[model samples]
Target: MRPLVELVGAGYAYEDGPAVLSGVDFGIAEGRALVLLGRNGSGKTTLMRLLSGGLRPGSGALRLDGEVVAHDRAGLTRLRTAVQLVVQDPDDQLFAASVEQDVSFGPMNLGLPVAEVRERVESALSALDITALRDRPTHLLSYGQRKRAAIAGAVAMAPRVLILDEPTAGLDPDGQERLLDVLAGLRSAGTTVVMATHDVELAVRWADDAAVLTPSGIRTGPAGSLLADPELLSSAGLRQAWAPAVTSFLRTHGFLTANAPGPRTPDSLTTWR
Candidate 1:
């Protein structure tokens, strides 16, 4: 399948600041989840902003669905509708008085009819399992509920690509699981998910592909391979998905096989004779 988005030789930096991203080349295939991993200030958010056309690259090209993005009113509008971004803080996105109103905001802005807007809002809330919160006040909702509401708003826009930044942040384990299930459902329905996160465990379990933003540049591959490489993980300011003990034990005993699949969880390596 053709890629939905591509960054070719992209470079970006804030005015008078050091380069956040340089010489980056990457692409996201339609209907696949690509996880972006890096430490704080490693350009993860900057890259997302660039892709969503909120910020232009200082150099090189960014293309969406095979067309290069230019910094103009028309192009930015097109980019916004084609690629929607959900920020780390749901509060920043959720400003409507009620959840239903919030979800309807996007479609409304698109000049959709009342009927269509209602339909989109309902469908998005149902998909995010936030239907019950439709009548609730946005400020009254819990953290997880607010996050889902923000996502519902984004989905109501029906963007071809969804960019999520630290989506699982500030959530409890149950909240994380709920968000994971929601994301999985989106992937099943053919929505491409590009998520930035520091949670290696979540990336290993959920993402099909992984890209690391290192001090050098962006490196990407199958999630399994990227998660298994200690050197790459370290360079990316991340840790292995499996515990150090398990990694060391496997290495010391020669049980780590070249052909073995990357370990998905801490307990996944346990094999009883």
Candidate 2:
């Protein structure tokens, strides 16, 4: 599949700060899940901001559908409609009086008809399973509820690509699982999902592909391949994801053949022959 977004030799740096991202070549394919895996300050957020048009790259190219992203007014407007970024913090994104109002904000900003905006808001709320909270005040929602509401806001925009920065940051285990289910539903419905995180387990189990941001630059590959490389993981400031550790243990005990496929999740270890 062709990439919905591509970064070719992209580089960026805050004023007077050393380059946070440099010489990066990457892509997020349409209708797929891509995990941006890296340690804190590994440029994951920077790359995400670049992708979402929040920050322009200081070097190289940022492209959407093979065309360079234009920085002019009309271009930027279209780009915003095409791609939406959900910040890591729910508090940063939600400010409207009520959940429905907050979720309606994006489509309304697009000058959509009131009926269409209402439809989008309802759909988004239903998609995130937060319809019951629609009339509630944003301030009263729990962290998980607020996160879902924030995501509903973005979903209402109906962007071709959804970029999430550290989506699992504050969720409990159940919250994380619910969020993952929503993301999986989005991917199945052909929404391209790109999420930034340091969680190797999430990357291994959820992403169709992934990219690792290292101090040196960015490395892109299949999620499993990247998770399996201990040296690369260490260099990138990541420990081996649990699936691989369990797979190794099973293999060493002669529980599986040398040519057996690796486990994608820790739970799959028991199924190895």
TM-score of each: 0.93, 0.95
Candidate 2, residue 116: CA error in Å?
Answer: 1.2
Candidate lDDT scores, in order, read 0.86, 0.87
Over 4 Å off, model 1: 243-248, 261-263, 267-273
Poorest 10 consecutive residues of model 2 by lDDT? Answer: 264-273
Clash count, predicted structure 1 = 0
Q: After superposition, how far is residue 230 of candidate 1 from its true place, in Å?
A: 0.4
Reference-based lDDT, residue 264, model 2: 69
TM-score of 2: 0.95
Span of ten consecutive residues with least summed lDDT in model 1: 258-267
Tens-digit per-residue lDDT, 46-99, candidate 1: 999888887898899989888898789888878888889999999999998999
lDDT of 2: 0.87
Please, what are the lDDT tens digits per residue for candidate 2 over residues 171-237?
Answer: 9999999999998887777788998888888888888788887777777888887778888889889
As for candidate 2, its clashing pairs are none
